[model samples]
Target: MASTEAPEVLRYAAFTGDPAGGNPAGVVLDATGLDASRMLALAAEVGYSETAFITGRDEARRRFSVRYFSPLAEVAFCGHATLATSVALAERIGTGALLFDTPAGEIGVDTVTGPDGKVRATLTSVPTRSRPAEAIEVDATLAALRWAAADLDPDLPPHVSFAGNDHLVLAAASRARLADLAYDFDALTAVMRTHGWTTVHLVWRESEGSYHARDPFPVGGVVEDPATGAAAAAFGGYLRTLGLVTAPRTVAVRQGEDMGRPSDLTVEVDPYETRVRVTGQAVPIP
Candidate 1:
């Protein structure tokens, strides 16, 4: 049974220090009495790309049980929501390390105030994996996106990457190609449902360590995500796996610029483990 009282919800934007930027997420720090149906209803009402509900907590271990939901359905994990929740927790309690028991796995997060006095959170994701997109899937996706093969970057091939949630990675040849994002929403949504993809990660590599990204999250009932931490983690894993970037390297991801809300994400990778680390600052949205 769920409580009749309305749960207190907090709104925060992740991957940026400015409230006007980044991806906004609804966070319910004390969702003890909420059931799955109630959680889903609250998430849909909030109208964010993703919302996080913390059901159980372990004070001794600083651990929490978290569930993620989009406007439409529940998801395995959501990185932006995790960052938002961590920042929310850090603001209330002292900032340090925290553990989250998500459906994907146990994720470790660290929060601290930077030299600029902004709260930043770093999340270590679960093990990640990637697989090349099949020809049929790619063809259908391309048709839905109205993108031609010539617009694709030759260096970065198409792959479906997973870091908690799955994303279809498509590297455009130029910044212009990436910026012009007018896709068939229903068509892409159908394809995403069929493949169980959270978002379509459209990116353009600017330099060896710098890249620009845009995410289409039709399944989440959102046209685009301002900042996508999950896709960023999966991208780091994909780069290391494909040897596009070496281990122990840091990649800078610039996103949401085209949408008027600019956000930045830092991705770190190592050769020793499959888990990718994503770091960014989050700000409360008043």
Candidate 2:
């Protein structure tokens, strides 16, 4: 990567085994000499929600320094891109444990090949955290989304959650409410920039351990994210913190179905651990 040669960017769709069913991300396995400006330019060219770059590596420790960039700017962390990068690495280096030093924190990734010959990656996120969203902030967000307060789920409440990056979590009162997602992009972008929010994690609880989600990522210069592992990680903490779900639970998230690219993610929360684990399969996009 240090060389001046053009970097080889690989494309992969994360959270689904099918190439067309998940979030697409660009992976630059070797990005040694690429500067921030070049990386950002490359990310914009790749044009996914985000692209992952491998800037440094340690062979003995199976560790690498990684950075994620959205089409607009650099991001603190990106779960789908992390999964894509891990699988891209595993394809060449063989599946096993890999550690990534990210701007947010150290992320632990484990990759294994399933019986169906698909590579599945599980990422362990940084410590999760959350706080109640201010009333004004909620009101502004609701206004931007064109949703009423009645559309909010009483049980979930409004909170800003963090698992590397900050996200505004809003639960829908019903599935229909979640499905109707026409919003003022510029207004929501303004609100997110003001609050340092990465995405608006709009969701609906389908059952005790299952949910559907849609993430508005205007901050990332994207209309929506097909699958959002970082938000799912933060949500696990939100659920645990609110006593909505008991610890040692696994939550199934179904995203992108409404967008035509269905994605599935499994989030695991441990009783004693603060970090959340998100697992999904990634496939090369031809």
Candidate 3:
């Protein structure tokens, strides 16, 4: 059978209202006939961190198959791409609830039009989990980042956390530390690949519910991610696991300022559930 070409891709930035401040995503509104190779090629051509392909939908249009691709490979799930895709769908189909069947698991996204008539996307991830980081792994990661163990935030120990994809959570003692992100990309990528980490979540906790964050995604062939939904979800799990925040609390993550693309992520933890809810707005890139 002949393969059909994919639909034209729409580009959008998620988590920030400004076009210059959020993570860029490629949204293929309809990917009925596109294959994995085509999607991956398209993603590489777009050169964004991730691109989302929307496959066929169920009878109610509430359930759909979604695939995510990075510049170099396909990811199990992508938070920023999910948000961008939801906002794009909301602009056309109107906002409500949508379910995505990703490689990792089912994800729920709710879209609501704000007072400004802008659609905001909220994604509820799979059940979250975390484990202590091995001493050797931590040391390797630090060496790749060119930082000493003392530079880490004592309150937030290193750990591997997952929402949809896995990430290593490393908290900085100060915002300055997070801002100065100079690391050996290849070295970091090797370490991340060894541990099956998607990205390194570098964070600085501002308060009980607010944080400043940066994500190094050398493994994805990107130096850094302007907006990271997966890392935010993982961080939420980390916060809950460490008893840093009570359940049913909302945490805000401020990211991308250092890279000139400022983005915001709102994470909500349910009292009785392990899933993390991440909310943000996405806008079309001009």
Identify the candidate with maximal lDDT.
Answer: 2
For residues 236-263, what per-residue lDDT tens digits would candidate 1 score against the true structure?
8888778776548889999999999899
Clashes of each: 0, 0, 0
Error of 3 at 83 (Å): 0.4
Model 3: per-residue lDDT, tens digit, 97-136?
Answer: 9999999899999999999988999999999998889999
- Report the C-alpha lDDT of model 2 over 104-194, residue by residue, as the tens digit: 9999999999999989999999999889999999999999999999999998999999999999999999999999999999999999999
User: What range of 10 consecutive residues in model 1 has the weakest lDDT sum?
Assistant: 238-247
Candidate 2 worst ten-residue window by lDDT: 238-247
Per-candidate TM-score against the hidden true structure: 0.98, 0.98, 0.97
The parts of candidate 2 lying over 4 Å away from their true place are 1-4
lDDT of model 2 at residue 133?
A: 94
> In model 3, which regions exceed 4 Å deviation?
2-6
TM value for model 3: 0.97
> Which candidate model has the greater lDDT, 1 or 3?
1
The residue pairs in collision within model 2 are: none
